[model samples]
Target: MENAERKELELFAAKMRRWIVEGVYCAKSGHPGGSLSCTDIICYLYNKEMKVDPQNPKDPDRDRFVLSKGHCAPALYSALGLKGFFDINEMKNLRKIDSFLQGHPCIEHTPGIDMSTGSLGQGISAATGMALAAKLDGKDYRVFSVLGDGEMQEGQVWEALMSAAHNKLDNICAFVDHNGLQIDGNVDDVMSLGDIKAKVTAFGWNAVEIDGHDFDQIEGALKAFNENRGSGKPFFVIANTHKGRGVSFMTDNASWHGSAPKEEQYNIAVGELDAKIKELEG
Candidate 1:
C-alpha cells in the first residue's frame, strides 16, 4: 500500500480503538482488550477489504463477516458505526438494556450484522454455512470471520474447520486473533493452540500467520484469500496481536480482557489514541 493509503487505514483503526475504549468505559462493562487487539483488522475489513454497503446492507451478494470471538463486539460496532451503519454516538449506549448495540452482536436488531454471534466457536460455523449457501445458490460472494486465540480451545471451532474443508468452502476465510492473553491469563497456560497454522493446515485449509496490527500483512493475507477463490479449500489467517493494543497500560494485560477501564485509565487510553489520530491526520 502507498504511504497515504496505509496512513488512512491506520488513522481509521486508531479512531476505532478510541471508540472501543470510550464505549466500554461508558458501559462500565464490556470486553476491551480483545476488541482493541483486533480493531485494526476489523476496521481494515470494513473500510477496505469487505464488499459491504451502508446504504444497501441487505444486499445478498455483499460479502459476509462474522466475529467468531463475539465479545469483541465493541470493535465490530465501532467499525460498523464509522462505516455509516448507524449513528456512531449510539456506541456510548453500548450494552444498555434498550440499545440496539448490545454487548454482543444481534443480527435481529443490528443493521450490518450478518449473524448473531456470542457463544465462542459458533460464528465460524455460521460463516462456513454462508459460504456453502453462496456456492449452492451459484453466487460469488465471500464469507469471513475472526476468532479469538483462546476460542480455539472450543471443540466446535475444529468441527467448523472440518466441515468447511470437507465442503471445499474456498470462498470462506477465517482469522485467529493470536493475542497471547485471554480473560483468565495466557492462552498457553489456559489451553495451548499448539502450532495453530499447522493445525489449521492439517484440517485441509490453507493457513497463513501474520502480525494482525500490520496493515501490509493484513492486505497481503486478504489478497491471498482472494487468489484462492477456486482452490477447493478454505483459508485461515493466524494474526499475532497484543491484547489491548494501542492502549499503553492495557497492552497485553489480561486484567483488561473483559473489564472496562476505570475513569482515569479511560482518560489515559483515550488521550493516547487521540494523540495518535491527530498525528496521523497531520
Candidate 2:
C-alpha cells in the first residue's frame, strides 16, 4: 500500500475502534475486547480488500465475507455501517428488541452478511460451500472468512479445512484471529492450539503468519493470497493480535472479553478513540 492509502486505512481503523467501543458501550451488553481486537482486519477487508458494494449488496459477482467468529458482530456491524451498508445511528440499537444487529450475525436480519452464524464451526463450512459453488460455476469472485483462535478448537473447523483443501478451493482465504485469549481465559489453559500455522499447512493449505494490527503486513499477505490463487491450495492467515488492542485498560485482559464498559470507562475509551481519529485525519 502507498503512503496515502496507508494513512487512509489508519484513519479507518481509528474510526472503527471508536465505533466498536461506542456501540458496545451504548448496548451495555456485548463483546468489546474481541470486537476491538478484530477491528483492523475487518476494516482492511471492508474498506480496501473486499470487492463489495453497499448499494448493490446482492450483486451476483461481489466478493463474499463470512464472520466465522460471529460473537464479534459489533466489529463487523461497525465496519458495515461505516461502509454505508446501514445507517451509523442504528448502532445504538444493537442487541435490542427488533434490532437487525444482533449479538451474532444473522443474514436474514442483516444486509451484506453472506452467512448467518453464531455456532462456532459452521461459518467456515458455509464459506467452503460458497467457494465450491463459485468454482463449479467458474465465477471469478473470492470468499473470505474470519475465525477466532478459540473457535478453531471445534471439530467442524478441521472438517471444513479438510474439505476446502481436498477440493482445491484456492479462491478461499481464511483469517484466524490468534489473539491467544478466549472468553474463559487464556487459550493455552482452555485448549492449546499448538503450531496453528503448521496445523493448517499440514491440512494442505498455504498458511502465513502476520501481525493482525499491522496494516502493511496484512495488506501484503492478502495480496500474496490473491496472487497465489489457483495454486491448488486454500490460503490461511494466522493473525497474531492482542485480545483488547488499542485500549489501555483492555489490552491482554480476558475479563473484558465479554464485559461492556461502564459509563465512566466508556467515556475514557471514547476520548482515546476520538483523539486517535483526529490525529489520523490530520
**Per-residue C-alpha lDDT of model 2 across residues 1-282, encoded as one tens digit per residue:** 789988898888887778788878888988988988888899999988889999988998999999999999999998999999999788888899899998999989888988998899999999999999999999999999999999999999999999999999999999999899998999999999999988999999998999999999999899999987969899999999998888889999999999899999998888888888888888
Question: What lDDT does candidate 2 reach at residue 75?
Answer: 90
Residue pairs in steric clash, candidate 2?
none
Compared with the true structure, what per-residue lDDT tens digits does model 1 show for residues 249-271?
98999999999988888889989
TM-score: model 2 vs. ground truth: 0.98
Model 1 lDDT on a 0 to 1 scale: 0.93
lDDT of each: 0.93, 0.92
Model 2, position 147: C-alpha lDDT score: 96
Question: Which lDDT value does model 1 have at 116?
Answer: 98
> Could you give me the TM-score of model 1 versus the true structure?
0.99
Best by lDDT: 1
